[model samples]
Target: MKQLYISFILLSLSFSNSYAYQNKTTKAVDKIVVTKKTQPTKTPIKISNAIIANFVNKYPNLKTYRSDLNNLYLKRNYKSIWFGGKGLIEFANLLYAKTNELEQEGLQSKFAYKNKINSIFTEKTTKNLASVDTELLLSAMYLFYAQKVYKGIESDKIKEIGWLIPQKNLSYATLLSYLLVDPKALDKNDTAQFNQYYKLREVLKKYRKIEQNGGWNKIVRDTLVFELKPGDSSQTIGQIRQRLATTGDLHSDSKSNRYDQELIDGVINFKKRNGYNEDPVITFSQISRMNIPIENYIKTIMVNMERCRWIDPEMTKAAQYIIVNIPSYKLFFVRNGKTELESNVFVGGTMNETVIFSGNINYMVFSPYWNIPTSIVQSEIKTALEQNKNYLVENEMESIKGRVRQKPGPKNPLGKVKFIFPNSNDIYLHGSPSKSLFQSEYRAYSHGCINVNKSEELAYLILKDNTEWPVERIKSAMEGGKEITCMLKEKLPVHMGYFTAWVSDSGEISFFNDIYERDDRLAEILFSEDYN
Candidate 1:
């Protein structure tokens, strides 16, 4: 019994000594951690508004962020943020590491005076020479991080790049306020940041890793001789399989040359991912796109990430709203933050590109007239009318003074119903007489408005709440007849936007072609501009 008691005492002492050593080691990143007595040093590195004012002079490049820095100190009563009674908080390392790896955020922007910040961390003794410069520098970095990662470029510059969507304007003061309460708030998913920005950041990491591993190889194809179809075997088929597997479109690469069902499925997945027709046949154009260097794909992702920065996260927070992705050629109806309906859409062609903007949907017109624009009247319909005097009668179009408008009928181009959202662009969502156009993968044939494939289903979904517009009434309304407008009880928000790369909630990343050719111009501006 005596030996057992002695053993217990020794064991407890050993554990107590080990824990003490570990606790000290954990906080020993800098010299200011603990005093000789091993009690936490309670001295706060005092900062004055004068100190902050002097900082802007030393680092005038951070002039823009002087605001959040000053606000942080004043609210904090000129105390430390990166430090505590213990010394440098552990999150300092985390923030420093993140700032170094900006590419992971799809940002090429550099933090101002990054090397000097690096020296402060590496050479800890230097903190003594300066009065709380380290503290202020870290504060400046947090503001810079928030600005680059969440708020993005200046709003006017985004508009200059042809992006008309609303920019996400963030308050650094609020961020600092949150940070003062909990330093870890900096790492949390910010409510103001467009949620997709994180998803794109995740994909950017994967693609950069792909780039590091020698990237994807280009498939050498003789256009005249190289064509892949089901049951046709070639070495090119194996290359295609490997390529699809790189992006996870294919489950596994059999590493076989045969064009089997597995390869066909991979081809379909690749096509769907790239906004191409889901056909098994592999063409030269598809291979050419595949051959586009992974570097280019990375740039596309970066450009889209910049676009995400310009989007207001709250734009989609309404009870019900619709989002039209022009490049992917699809429309999504979201209710209560869940996607309730998805429809294939055909948007404007290159020459008449659909404007990127948002508006409230207030009404829907059943069997609406196609008021042919004056440009088309002078350029097309007028010429046709001159060619054949009976063209108006043949096409069900009427001449009311100088204007030409097609009457609501079976042959009407506006299809059965058109959803109206008043905007300066004069664009809205509507149906088309030609449903076959929706089947084609390259669905950019419209003039300026969007053509929803499931107009009947959309009408039913939109008015499902109203007892007045039941299924029977909706069916009757869709029937060709005199034009009738049904005003919505509540305005539904709709946003028309452009994105060439998108990451689904399930983590599936899709890369769509830049239909409007806007990416290159935007990329040029972003790469050249100093985020500071």
Candidate 2:
């Protein structure tokens, strides 16, 4: 009976194993096969042809936009589902947003519904197509057009948009584009606009480089030290430090007292060499100079390089010329390619800013007359007339029908001689009795005219070749109190410019205070993304 039971169990086990193996083989066969269906492989997003046609028809000028939309549809039209066709859907949304004819409510609803569609191309489609340069250029062109339209249309809405124009960035972008396209095309002789633009580019390039090199991370700790020669003695240090202290660099502190006298003397010598008054107390300015990043110096040099390129080529070859470096408050006279003379000059006051210009020296007047500007007469003389009826007489001022004038006299604002250049703005070079004003670093104290301290010397130099007048003869002519209108043998060029930073002739970099606050405005525009 046991043997019969064992045989039955063996037979049942064999049957169970066979059944499991058949079931496993059937499952493997099912996994190996891929079944075919009638559905398409790629899905398409839903876009109404009517809506697209209406949009294109409304903006007849947008043929290009419509064409791009058509291309998107043709490339991805295989998909059946609306959301799956990402490119077409995105094109539809952009069209809706950019179209002015679409009702705001309808467009908003469409945008909201379309945004729900998930696809690979969604993010790319929504990106801003306007690049920095393109936007800046467009903004500038629009600004130029808007001004013309603003003049024609008296509507406040038009004027408001015109006023909202980004002028600074636009101007910078336009200048950069011009330079990059044809740098040589910018006249080297026209320093006014060219120099300003060049300087701006330099500053911008420098700031960008600094930002690129991890910004202030590269800053290293440095102590101010006087530049020394290989075999200099230490005795002169204390005196140098004292001089430096007077110039606002050194503080009265225990830490400052620890500075060795040899170090002080070396700093003083460095200051003297670098065009600062010989002072030894190390101040913040000196510290800044010592610690300036290499990138900043590079930018400074580049800024001047651009300036050199922008300088009017005409000035470079002028036989005789006067250059007023606005930042330096100094005038340089070049005769036959040599620097003949230099003197301090007082420029326009803060309220009456000195304008950059270049013109020929047509004539000069001894004991010159002053023609007060119309704006000045209205703003200043009008107020003075109220205070005292004889105000004009007291100041040697006479009134014409609509202008105020000053006669040639001791009390005349125009001291001795005036160099007349026929400019529409009525600006000229002249001498002022307020000689003390020239001593100040911030010498903006004139009425839009340049006042030279050594006018007699300048007059002699300008007229020596043409007038047969030696220095003595020129002095005699001026002392005679006669207005002399001598024609220039060759009309000399005069250039007035503003530069806050420049490289000196000796190759040392120098920085001047931005007395006119012009640098900051320019910097803001140059450093922004749109300007690039």
Candidate 3:
């Protein structure tokens, strides 16, 4: 009886302890629930139409985003997108990060309210989310980024700078939809912009870092010309070596102050890259050009990047295309995504700048007659006729349509052949009777047409696939002394563009003279405070 009594007591004591513990545990759980319920979490703000209207009216600079923002809100029924049921969307953070990296993306433009927009992230608060300012600012920034990166300068501004290529219009609605689906849409959709822009963007970063670290020393310009020759030692020689080393044109700075063989090779490389005819002696003009601040080169690179943005990326990837860069005075024949041939070319003079446009080369005229333009006839030929009555016969000239045209002969201005792309500009690629011009470094003496140094080789390449026109037949046609027009089996696209900075297939950066001074006008517009 005593054992049973003792066991019952222990069991009752255990049950009492267990009951108290259960009550304590239940109260702790309730406390946690209460705490969670009282926590001050951010409540998503309602994006009402009235609030949007008020914000839009207050921030007039963001007019570009107004229509798109309105459509976005109406579609979502006035719910905040950047800020959601959970503080902020992931895509909002992504867009913010991209805006911060505008410079690295080759954009020098600024957002008017960048600071205010950035503060939203730093001083993140529920109240900030409640208002529409943050969202509207983000919208504006997105437009600005898109404009500078994908769209480039405004259409009117491009037209003012004489860019005839069609401007690509990026749809904000489509971009937003893509972002909603994948916040990384911007980087993934790089194909929308020219690939060269990205390549140059990488190059730009290196140049920018170099600029920050203090660019190359300016070469002396007071001297008439740098009479630099191998084995010549002088103060100017030392400066030249230093300049070349700074630009990576020379392997290293020997500090010897001697114009050695290494310096000669370096000068040749520099001259070739700068569109100069390679020469043994460095000229005064070359020294003056080297003296130009590296900052100017940076600006040129930026300007060409803007040009790259203007191009259609797909056009560059065509199976066969001919691209003529007027500023560089070079022509590239690209086939199957590789540069098959490059030729030195003569473009227009300053007064007769080549037009920036694209055309399809479908015809070739062998032994083409040089029908002198009316402008040339009036300005030059008429006076020559008065000076020499027999000048017509002397030049193998005849009258047709009240205009003088050189007959098909060795003396004809259009040597051997010409490739025609029908256009209103009346420009065509042809061989020049002044073949000596091909040897000159600065060969921009033509009226407006382009003269190919290797015109015969170009003809052979163009008609290579056609068994009917072999090299012999082509040569025969060119020398037949009659104007013969033949249509191509396939029309090749030819793009005549003006770019002062270019990157070759081997990743060498080449700079050319801005013959028409187009870069200055573009820089003015690009650096304007009012630029959008």
Candidate 4:
């Protein structure tokens, strides 16, 4: 009985020693979550849920994020994510730097409690471990930065600025967990964001670098010089060469005043990218275009990046879709992840601006009679009849049930074919009888519907897989004697968008005229938070 009692005591002592030594020898990184005041030497890296609740109460600036803060801590079981046992974690420094550099994400302002947050990082005023204020402030700043960069301005505000594209539903609180695990996720262009956003981000960095390098000087046009062409020599030509070189349009700057073949090639390339007629002549107007300040370009980039954030990143994965960019006056047809065709298009006039929205191409109408809208019939047709009694006869138009209808022929404005999409706006894509307007750089003469330059080609591309409507059949249907409608096997998605700045797959950055003047309105909301 004495030996048995001794053995039992030894077994109990061994169990006690093993239990005591398990977590004691582990490092802080091994997640030895100690409660506050439990260990004198180690400041607890985890705190009570009440700590977050009380911290947000003291900081009214973070009051907007009270629920988000609570939800984050609750998910982590009240662990201090930004703080390790010794000091601030590595992600804390990265996140602080990102908050300070908000301009990279197109934000002009910092978090409201920036000064208080800075005190935690500065050596002179560094806080002790388990700093609740620092912990909570970093949490709030992370939300702000994540919302600005990953999600962008609020959905309603972007809608107020006439952005009809669908907005993303991002959970910044959930994203915090990823950053806690891997800090590098802070800068990675995750698939969650639109692909265009990353492309624009890269371009913004490149343009800012150019701005820091003194930008380009203004070219002075002399009274003696009217137009500059190849073989022409002037100081303005030298300035143009330097400007193109700075923008990566020209291979190199020779610093020569004489306009050579190299300068001519650069001029054409610049004009092509800038939505202008590709002409070698460098006129006064061209000089003005080249002289727009670099700062404006940077803001333009920022504005477009915000637009990219509003779109679903996975939108481009469609098997086939059509995208019409209003500002660029172009249409792109993509199939199997490749752009099959690109065509010039003319949008609505100022009086009847095209709506920024999306739809599905339901069917195609061949040699269809133009059913003129009531407003156009009253305003335009009546006025034409008042001026000339033979207007209807000359135009091959007839009045039908109080509405005028144009006969499908050479006289019709909607030439041979039109693509119809169901929308309340009564907008559709059609060919133009007068092709002269398509050749113009500023082709916004349409009443409302888009006038496609290559409407027949578009039809063929859309009906390529059908095998029912070959090229010859399509041609016969467009003969204007009878109207015919062909429904698509599957509806093709169509997105009418406006982007002033666009980056092609080849990294070619192009800027077009903001036809609706929308960039400023959005940029104001993004920078000023006027939506609040």
- Measured by TM-score, the strongest candidate is 1
TM-score of each predicted structure versus truth = 0.89, 0.50, 0.85, 0.86
Model 4: per-residue lDDT, tens digit, 145-247? 8777888777777777766766667777678877777776777655557888878888898899999998889888887878888898888899999999999
TM-score of 1: 0.89
Off by over 4 Å in 1: 1-50, 74-79, 124-129, 179-185, 188-190
lDDT of 1: 0.81
Error (Å) of candidate 3 at residue 285 is 1.9
For residues 1-532, write the lDDT of model 2, one tens digit per residue: 9999999999999989966644443233213211111122243224444544554575453332444344334444522211222222222222222221111111111121122221121232343321221212222222222222111112343223212111211223343234335534322213223333334443445455555655432212233444433343332333334434432234431223235665555566555434355555555455555455555544444333423433434455667788887766778899887889898888877677777666778878887667787787788889989999999888877778867888776777777788887887678888877777666656777777888988877887787665466677667656655556655667777887666665444433356555576554443332334322
Per-residue error for 146 in candidate 3, Å, reads: 0.7
lDDT of 2 at 413: 70
- In TM-score terms, candidate 2 sits at 0.50
What tens-digit string does per-residue lDDT give for candidate 1 at 374-463?
988989987897899999999999988878899998788888999999988899899888888788978998898999998768888999
Show model 2 residue runs off by greater than 4 Å.
1-300, 400-402, 470-473, 524-532
TM-score of model 4 relative to the true fold?
A: 0.86
